[model samples]
Target chain A: MGMMKHLMVRSRRRSLWMMHFCLGGCNGCSIEIMAALTPMYDLERFGILNTGNPKHTDVLLVGGSVNHRNRRTLKNLIDQIPAPRLIVAVGTCALTGGIFNEAYNIIGGANRVVDVDVYVPGCPPKPEAVIDGILSGLDKFEQ
Target chain B: MTVSVIPVGPQHPVFLEPFQLKLVVEDEVVSEALPRFGYVHRGLEALVVSKDFRQMTRVAERICGICSAIHGMTYCRAIEKLLGITPPPRAQMLRLVWSELHRMHSHLLWLGLFAEAMGFESLFMQIFRIRETVMDILEQTTGNRVIISVNVIGGVRRDLDAEGADGIRRALKKVAGDLERIRPVLVDDYSVRKRTEEKGILAKERAYELGAVGPVLRASGISQDIRRTGYGAYGELDFEPVVESGGDCQARCKVRYRELFQSMDLIRSGLDRLSDGEIQTKSKEKPEGEILVRSEQPRGEVVYYIRADGSKHLQRLRIRTPTFANMAALMDLLPGLDLADVPLVTLSLDPCIACTER
Candidate 1:
């Protein structure tokens, strides 16, 4: 990688800005994602910010499962995010659709639509597990 | 006059769930608001066909992560009624304890979010810091936070021993103390009142006509709490519905604030009533009839309707979540609000769209 490119990748690793998008399942994973941002787990200490705009995000943390209606929004968000970005499928619902996999109008997990770089597994994973998953996804981000 | 129609969600920074609100803005004031759903709809109610009634307990809980225990409890309560089986007294009391605990944590979660909604960022952090105590108590007792999986088909799946009981008491003491420190900022602070009071006011009669439930209705001076029906151990517990007459965002916030203490008291009394007995009463009998059960979740009243025909799977399972009931009231609140206050006022209703669309 070129010098400026290497510096950009290293700085992105230091401060990973994540944008959360809820797909199709319950609010469990979404709450957990918020919990990770709050005081006790303190994702801010790691220099991570939960951003609102897709263009400002370095990582996309998807909650819930993928379904017909929300898949379009998810793809739109993914298209807007700058590359060298990471896509993290948080919670079991986002991984393999958890319990909502077989429901009609449900198209399974986040992988059904986009490639998930990291998978956090739990019916709803703990904030600690969520942090770990996101950091690992940062490790897998390409230059 | 050029009125701009602004789309608020389905994926907005303000909401944790995917729900849309189309607000018609005239001169920076909202003249009309329309909501759209189906983004988070996973067809969970229909999943009762594939997953058996027993398995649907977990599925029911998944409808909303914040109020999962109550969802599972309401589902089990409906099935128990259908089969004509009653959970043991101790089991009922345990459910009351855990559910009350869930209520505390869920209210704290909302309070934190409500604080953030008004741009009180530091207060938001402080509130969530206190919420961790309640979550810890739940984790200590049930071995999980958020969706504890304590409720089951016949009865509760876990019991609180003496150590666990003491731990909860201590933790609740700390939660109460921490909440006390922040109570003034939440209730009496000039900035808080300035931001919340008289914003998005809903009248008592209108709230009733619109079918609002839980804190939203209670804030409008309707003291209708499903717990008043005395389901489970609520019959034995001594408490009153926390009601406020402001009928605005502040009143709704105050109602939930007061309920946090009520929940704490309920938990303490519920522990006092916890006598030694079998936690689970096994039932091999299949549920064969149709029945509906209502339980008060952290948000409001949740109704579970179950129809069965002597089979493992239910014929039909329908859920009427509190957020669904409050939609009309929400639409009613938006017309007079400024565009900036829209998120705050909508959050005051504590709309859990995941549960609604499910």
Candidate 2:
């Protein structure tokens, strides 16, 4: 337990690599997230970076509305990310499917697949808001 | 050796949307590639038939978050055309401003993702940092970040005054300057070039044959921009589509990179030509005809087909997103590339699976 705590703290400071999964979303949140990584927002100063491989990630930032087709994939990805992992549900779609909530195809939001640690609500959350969500997720990892 | 079929998505690290890519790989090279969509199929088209015109704007905006403004704009334009209502000049300019803002942010977001896909961590961070300014400006002006909900049937719901326009212009200038700084990183950086150049080569002939749109088409040396048709305030703006001949991942990157500057210029010009009038015209009559509205979204050309039945609700709404057109290009581009480059190349097209499946 002590070793796990120390490793968590060390990992939290070293790199908070994030892997984003789009279940079924308009790509707004995902785009805003990508915006968060660009030169304008530059989330790297805080050690936040996007990881291509889930195995290398510390957080999973899930975007879009979840649907039947992507539910299993979302679950599989959540399980793949190494533990002590934080899950951030970005955008209103990921939180509650927002405007798509009542749609027949949508399976609600990200929480339907895995446990979400933080929720950033917006049709598509702003880049700054995404940054804040990442920071808060990092804080959770530290705790 | 043995060939293995590895499934990459439906939900994967590299893809944000749910779609399955069946990669038949022999060692590190992909021999066969199959893409399966319909993961997030929300029957959006069917919903359009059920919801009233006002409620459908909400549905249209939900089609793709990155191009929500265009979706809303296109839907409104289609409805407006059907109802025979011309929005005031000021409203047109406002729509242009917001649309260009959406384009600016959308392109920046894709660039960051491209950097991330290429494994260039620092560049990704730098690009996203600059994207924040645009988002902040959007939030302040539109009152919402992702889905601004500013587009109404006849015109627009939001208005920007002189001070607001000036502030947005200043913000655009800053974004333009930031893009300039990042441009070299994407264009001249040796690593970026190494990873992107000659990778995912979509020949010009094939791009056209497959109906690729936006930067993907522009990268293939096609100068087809929906803006050229003079929709919205684009007709009034002085601009040219950015085209590149390379037809590779790098070329696609260049097209988007150049478009960032073009969008900024368009925004500045739109602001300069700002006129004062009512933002929306009163339209109590229901639309009664069919119209096809095309707009250049941040991704590419989006076609909104509306069939109204002289009622408040639309009889039918069909949206063909840029990503849907680009999907055929994806099937062609992925097969001949190394497995490692699959994600990078796929992302270069900026495939919005949600938009495609919706």
Candidate 3:
């Protein structure tokens, strides 16, 4: 178990391929995630690559809120991702479902569906804040 | 050739948001395409009952990040109409400037994504790098990069000083210059043309019938623009809709590229016409009537329907986003196209699923 923890720690700091899932929120957080991937923020410097496939993803970067319709799909995506995966919930919606939390269809935040490793809060968190949240998630894994 | 079903999205790399497209294919050609919505449906319209009309502007802004400014402006416009109040001349001009800036950023973001769809990595990077300048300017002015909540009921919450206005002018100038260099690349470049030309042809009549808004309609040789409705400061500005004849992916790209320059010109003119005045007014009266307000978003025309019952909260708030109107065109455009062209065609419409579903 100790050796497995050390291996997980080493792998966490390396290239982390992220699969982004948008359950149901505004496009604000999704665009901010895109910005983080682009030249200015360049999240690639931290060895974070945005991938489309859930199976290969080390981190699941979820945008938006989990609603009734997408609950099963969200669970499927989380189930698909390999173990020891970190889920970083971006934006206010992902953290606590933001404005739409009280809506009829919504099932609240990302944590409502699956355990969230980190929550980056903002109407749509800035690219810098998103990166900081990811870094902080990395720190959590180190322990 | 036997037909096989190919599913895309609900979560796909090509789509920045979640929505499914089920493509029925024979050989390599898509026979029929079925789009499934409700992926990003957060029931925002229902929130009107919970939150007051004043707070709904911010909620409306979160409908789509790319067109956030216009969403807020349109919501405010609806409220202003119901209250029978017009924002001060300076506030209107400021709205124009910010709206035009938002348009530029949105078009640039689309261009970058379009380039990515075409598999042009360097061009995508260049477009985004240029887009970052606009984001920076938005951040500096509105204090937030993506969802700038500048719009209030009667007027804007934030005011741009002379120095800030100068900064905007400089940024617009730089963006215009950069766009000038990238113009030929978008419109006439061989590889881009090879991929986009005549790929998804929505004829003029068909586009109108499908209710395609904004660049899609303009690209189909229709000069219909909501700006001509003369809402906000657009009435004061003199400009024509950027039109193209082809109605294909190429034409759509041309229309967006041309509109970028047009938005820059609008901003410059807005800045010139911008007068010194109060940014906002205290609203003593609660909204009492129902008003439907329309604004030209970057993707297309967005209609906001607000029903207020002589109270702080609205009885119903319905938003008809551009994507919701344009999705009908996709049903027409998707079939009979190559499987590989799906992303290009889908993205050409600039589907803001968040706005569409919300």
> Largest DockQ belongs to which candidate?
1
Minimum summed lDDT over a 10-residue window in model 2 chain B is located at B9-18
Error of 3 at B281 (Å): 2.1
Best-first order by TM-score: 1, 3, 2
lDDT of each: 0.90, 0.83, 0.89
Model 2, residue B253: what's the lDDT?
91
Best candidate, lDDT: 1
lDDT of 3 by residue, B1-358 (tens): 7789999978888899989999999997999899888878888889877888888888889888899999999999999888888889999999999988899889999999999998888898889999999999999999998899999988998999988989998888888888888878888888889999999999999999988998999999999899999999899889999999999999999999889889988998899888988988667898988788899999899998888899888898999999999999988999999999999999998888988998
For residues B34-127, write the lDDT of model 1, one tens digit per residue: 8888899989889977988899999998898889889989999999888888999999999999999999988999999999998888988899
Better of 1 and 2 by DockQ: 1
The digit string of per-residue lDDT tens for model 3 on A4-72 reads 988878878876898788879888888888888899999889999988899989888899999888888
Pairwise DockQ winner, candidates 1 and 3:
1
Candidate 1 residue-wise lDDT, A4-94, digit = tens: 8888778888898888998887888888888888899999988899888899998889988988899898998899998878998998889
- Using TM-score as the yardstick, the better of models 1 and 3 is 1
- Each prediction's RMSD over C-alphas, in Å, is 1.1, 3.1, 1.6
Clashes of each: 0, 22, 0
lDDT of 2 by residue, B176-242 (tens): 7888877777899888789989998888899999999989999999999999999888888888899
